[model samples]
Target: MWHISEYDIDKAVIKLRHENADFRRRLKHEMLLPTDIENIICMASFGIIHLELQPQIIKCKKQ
Candidate 1:
């Protein structure tokens, strides 16, 4: 898990909106874990990271 800033969220949204394929490829190549993606989503949904700066709080447990 990671704490993402509002700026990072905006940048990620823009990058995804314009270059989803590239973003996915990069995320995979960069070895981003599932928790990373969950944190990103939470940041975007809340529109602010400061309110909830916890990491890996929303990650799914491995089987």
Candidate 2:
């Protein structure tokens, strides 16, 4: 499991809506599914320049 914020989800949804209002209106109001967000994250990650992704698992440590 990963820690994701409601604010982050809302921000993403708002961005999506701006990009395509009709598609956004068709979606129901509900919490974002993790898989949906994961897909979005994967797509966005590719947008980063010079970022490397390693295929390995790392446990999160709370500060």
Candidate 3:
């Protein structure tokens, strides 16, 4: 299980903001930018997807 800290989230948000700016700059016309809510959803989705793809390990104890 991954333990995400506030610092990690902040870093991700910064990276995402930079990407968004680049995309916006490339567009000839203005478009609606992602809202804060959308960003939060994206972060949550990333975490869930990552967890789903990660390998599960099972532990057994011999009695």
Please provide, for model 2 over 1-63, each residue's C-alpha lDDT reduced to its tens digit, 9 standing for 90 to 100: 444456655665666667755435434444334444553454444433232445443332445
Candidate achieving the largest lDDT: 1
Q: What is the C-alpha lDDT of each candidate?
A: 0.55, 0.47, 0.47
Best by TM-score: 2
Q: What is the lDDT of residue 28 in candidate 1?
A: 46
Indicate the worst ten consecutive residues by lDDT in candidate 3: 51-60
lDDT of 1 by residue, 1-63 (tens): 656567877776566646666556546456444555654666575644434334532333445
> Can you give the TM-score per candidate against the true fold?
0.31, 0.40, 0.34
Q: Residue by residue across 1-63, what tens digits does model 3's lDDT show? A: 555567766666566667776534523233323443245335745655332222332232345
Ranked by lDDT from best down, the candidates are: 1, 2, 3
lDDT of model 2 at position 45: 44
Q: What TM-score number comes out for model 1?
A: 0.31
Candidate 1: regions farther than 4 A off: 1-8, 11-29, 47-63
Worst 10 residues of 2 by lDDT: 43-52
Error of 1 at 33 (Å): 0.2
Query: What is the Cα-based TM-score of model 2?
Result: 0.40
RMSD of each: 8.8, 9.9, 16.1
